[model samples]
Target: MALGRNISPGQGAKYYRKDDYYIEKEGGEEHKLEWGGKLARDLGLQGKVDAETWEKALQGHFPGGVEIQGGSMVDPKTGERCHRAGTDFEFSAPKSVSIQALVFGDERLLQAHKEAAAEAMAFLEEQVGARRGHAGKTWETTGQALTAYSRSCWTPILPHDGQ
Candidate 1:
């Protein structure tokens, strides 16, 4: 199961841990950087997501002299401010798959799920649009989004006889 929602600038802080708990819970196995596309790469937002970089990216502050606020800049960069900082996405495997991975200690199963989630995010990024131009004469343009693999957890509920 997978779920996602737009993240506001204010809510960005809460997500900055970048999977620490998940890593600890998963026996110190770190989650891979599987999302964030060309835009993120071009902006030099790489490796593990740090709080500073995450915040900067959310506010449209990028390297090589580019600053975007409210989704729009001027002259060389033009667009209106975007209310959303980014999207919070979660991709969960079925219980059986999770159990299989856990029982066999198979990293491949988790990797497959991450890969699938990345593909979905990439596709959505291409289809998503953002507002541009001044308020009165605004237009819609393709949106560039940066996504980080925040965390993953599996808490299964099973019927047990209290063995």
Candidate 2:
């Protein structure tokens, strides 16, 4: 018998029986069939077959067997493929630019900028000291402070016109 075959009432007038059969009533109309009865009936089985035979047939037809092959090709000599060669892809050394133009425009603003940076650095150092002996904690605290300052400075430099 199918699992969950105990006789019990379900939604509306649907009732399940011990043999996995069910009676369903809709708009005062009643219909009866075994579990998966419609499918079996459609397959031309007229009456209930033994559980073993049904199970064997079901297992035989079950859509469970599948095989997958990993067919990715790799070249042992030169790693992975590149879209372009040396001429199309050129690399240049990174250039360091002054932060003065970014944070200040004039002499007065330059002094203010220096003071702000010093204060931020001091605050970060204090946080690192507070996390003394905890290597991960100090690194995390410093990273958070640096990230906040970097984000604040970079936000204005990013293009937001189209977005």
Candidate 3:
């Protein structure tokens, strides 16, 4: 009899077996990544979260941004495509000291970042759409939400002049 493992919907996030983990990425199929196992665990992924969770939250809820899927990267300077591997994980908190804000605590940072990034993206898309002759782009909400999101995330943690 051949040895096999039953597959589950969310198991695609991280398939584990025999004290080893089988991690499948978006383009992992193209890369022919059969099994990563201990060699990958040694690299420090720690299996905090899964891809499907993050993907469903971001794209399904509020789509668009840099399009970080399938392990592909775009060169900013020359606009070229590149292949990149690995997962980006971080634990975030509310970063606020308010009583009401304390309710959410630190668990909302990832969602906050993803949501803000999505709003910013949607704003840009709408503006571009308007320029291309599309209608229904509202500047009011875009100015508020998109700006707040950008300022909150990309705040200058440095001291310098615009010179």
TM-score of each: 0.63, 0.19, 0.21
The residue-by-residue lDDT of candidate 3 on 47-106, one tens digit each, is: 332344333422322233233222344533346664422222222324452223345554
Candidate 2 on 41-84: residue-level lDDT in tens?
34444333333333333222322332211112222234543221
lDDT scores in order: 0.58, 0.28, 0.31
Cα lDDT, model 2, residue 97: 19
How should the candidates be ordered by TM-score, best one leading?
1, 3, 2
Q: Please provide, for model 1 over 106-142, each residue's C-alpha lDDT reduced to its tens digit, 9 standing for 90 to 100.
A: 8898778768877887787776666455666765646
Residue 129 local lDDT, model 3:
15
lDDT rank order = 1, 3, 2
Point to the candidate with the largest TM-score. Answer: 1
lDDT of 3: 0.31
The candidate with the higher lDDT, 1 or 3, is 1
